[model samples]
Target: MSALARNRVGQYEVASDLSFGDLSAAVAAGWRDFRAAPLYGLFFAAIFAAAGIGLSYYFYNRGELAWLIAAAAGFPLLAPFAAAGLYEVSRRRLSGDSIGWGPVLGAVKAGDGQLPVMGVIAFVIFAFWVILAHTVFGVFLGQSGLGATPLQTLLTPAGLGMLGVGSAIGGIVALFLFAITVVSLPMLIDREVDFITAIIVSVRVVQLNTFLMLSWAVIIALLAFAAMAPAFVGLLVVLPLLGHATFHLYRRAVR
Candidate 1:
C-alpha cells in the first residue's frame, strides 16, 4: 500500500466519546456485518466448544480440588488460542474478508509475538480476580461458620449472602478488566497497534459508552452461561457468533 493509504488506515481512531447513537449504531452494524459471515462463525464456535468440552471433561473427572488447581494452570495455557481467535475476528472484519479458517489461522501464526503478550495480560488479570474471589469466600466463611458442610456452605442462606457479596466485588473487578481489554486484543491483531494503545483505547471506549458496554457484557455472560449449560455443547454455535460479533463491535467503535 502507498504511504498515504497506510497513513489513512493507521489514522483510524477508536472514539472515546460513546453516545447512544454510537452504541446503537455499533450494535446494529455488528449484527449486520456478522450475519454476512454466518458459516465462518459457526466453524469458529464449533472448534472452541470442542476444545472447551474436552478440557472440562478431563478436569471434572479429575476431582473438584484437582479441577480448581487445573483451572488456574490451564487458563494461561489456553490464553494463546483465545488471543488468536480475538485477533482473527478483528482482522477478518477490518479486511472485509470472508471469515475463512485459513486466513484466521494465518493471522494467528503471523501475530505469534502478540499472542503470548496478550495471553499473559489476560491470564494475570484472570488469576488476580480468582484469587480475590476465593479470599473473599474464605473470609466470609471464617466470620460466619454458618454450621454447614462445605457444599452446604455455598448453598445455605448465610453462605449465599456471603457468596453474593464476594461475587459483587469480583464482578466489578471483572467488568473493569473486560472494559479495558474488550477491544484491545483485536485492535492489536488487526492494526498492529501496541498493547498499551489498544488497552487505553479500550478503556476509553468503555468510559464513553458505559451503559451500552455493560449491556453488551451482560449479554455475553448470559450467552456463555447458556452455552455451558448443556455440557458445553451449545458453545459450538455461541462462541463463533460472539467472536465475530465482537469484531464487528470493534469496527463500529473505532470508525
Candidate 2:
C-alpha cells in the first residue's frame, strides 16, 4: 500500500507491510518534530503549572478535607487540559505547522468543548478504581483480626505482614491503572478518537513496550517529584517538556 493510503490510528500507521524499522523511524521523527517547538512547550507548561498551583493552594487553604477529597475526585476533570497541550503538539507536528502559542491555544480551545465529556468518563473510571482499591484493602487488611487500628497492630509481626501485603497490592493496582491511562488521554486528543479506543490502544502500547514505558513512567515520577518539591515552581518548565515529550512518545508508538 502507498504511504499516503496508510490508515492512521492515533499515531500508528496501520499498514500491513510496515516494519519495526519503520516504527522506529516514526518515533525518531516524532522526537525531532517535538524538539522544534521547545519554547511553545515551555509556554504551555507555565500555564498548566500556574493553574495547578492555584488550585492546590485553594484546596490547602480551605482546610476542608472534603476539598482535598473533591480535588482528588476532580482529578479527571483536569485530565483533558493536560491532554490538550500534548494534542496540540502532536497535531501541529503531524500537519507540519509551525508551532507557536497562538496556534496551540487555538487548537486546544477548539478541543476544549470535549473536556467535560472526557472528564466525566475519567471521573467514573477513577471512582471505580478507588472503590476497587479500597474494597481490596478492606477485604485483605481490615478482615485481619489484628486490632482496632492497622497502625497499632503493626507493632506485631502479623500486622507487619498484612501491611506489607496491602501495600504491595495497592502499589500493583496503582501501577496497572497508570499504565492503562498514561497515553490514553493524549491519544484521544491527538486523533479525535473516542475515550475507550484511546485507553485500549494505550494499554496495548504499554503491554507492547513495558520496559521502555516503565522507564518513561519513572522519569515522569521523578520529574513530578522535583517539581512538587519546590512549591511546584519547577513545574512551569517540567510539565510542558513532559507534555511535549509525551506527545512525541505517542506519535512514536502508533505510526
Candidate 3:
C-alpha cells in the first residue's frame, strides 16, 4: 500500500528483492487467516481430499493402483485452482471484508471470468500430465504389469527407474505450473487483470526472486506429498495452510 512497496515493471506495479523473511511472514499470515476461518478452510480441504480419495479408489478398482504415484506427483498441478476459494478467504481477512460462503464461492467470477479460464488451463495441464504419466509408465514398466501388488511393482528396478523418470518429468511440469500460477490465481481475485497478464506478472515475480520462489515451491511439494500419504486426510490441514500462505505471498510479492 505504500510507495516503498511498489516496484514498477513495464506499466505494472510489482514487488522485487523478496527474501526469506517475506516467505516466513506470508506463512505466518496464512496461518492466521486459516485460524480466523477454520470452517471455510476445512470445507475446501475436505473437497480436495474427497476428490483424491475417489481417484485412488477408481484406480484401485481398475487394478492400476500403481498410477497413484504419478497421480500424487501431478495432483498438485490442480491445487492452484482448488485454492481459489482459500484466496478469497485470505483476501477478505486481509482487507477486513466480511467472509462468507457466497462471496468466497463467487470469486471464480472476480476477474471478469479469468479465474475460470485459469481453471480450464489447470485441468488441461493435469490431463496432459496424466496422459504423459501413462506413457512413461508404459515405456518403463508396462511389461511387468503391476507385479503381484502395486507396492511390490513400484519396488522393482524397472519401477524405480520409472519413478525416477516420471518424477523428474513431473517435477519439471509442476514447477512450470507453479511459476505461472503461484501469484496469478490470487492476483486474479485481487485485481481485474486478464489471465495472460496475470501469468506474465506471476512469472516476473518468480524471475525476480528465483531462489526464494523455488524454495517455496519445494516446500509446497514436500508438504503436499507428505499430506497425501495418509489417505489425503492431512490435506485438510496442509492445503488450507498452503493456500492461504500463497495468497499472502502474492500480496507481498505483487502490488
Residue 230 error, candidate 1, Å = 1.3
146-239, model 1: which lDDT tens digit per residue?
Answer: 3435677669776787668765875676686677667776676677676766777777667666787888777776777677678667665556
Q: Predictions ranked by TM-score, top down?
A: 3, 1, 2
Clashes (backbone N, CA, C under 3 Å), per candidate, total 0, 5, 0
Q: What's the TM-score of each model vs. the native?
A: 0.73, 0.60, 0.93
Poorly placed runs, candidate 3 (over 4 Å): 1-7, 149-152
Backbone clashes, candidate 1: 0
Can you list the residue pairs that collide in candidate 2?
Answer: 11-254, 11-255, 12-254, 12-255, 13-255
Residue ranges of candidate 2 with Cα displaced over 4 Å: 1-39, 62-83, 100-103, 106-116, 123-177
Candidate of highest TM-score: 3
Task: Write candidate 2's Cα lDDT for 119-151 as tens digits.
Answer: 565557656655654454455455564344636
| lDDT (0 to 1) per candidate | 0.61, 0.58, 0.87
lDDT, residue 9, candidate 1: 29
Cα lDDT for residue 253, candidate 3: 89
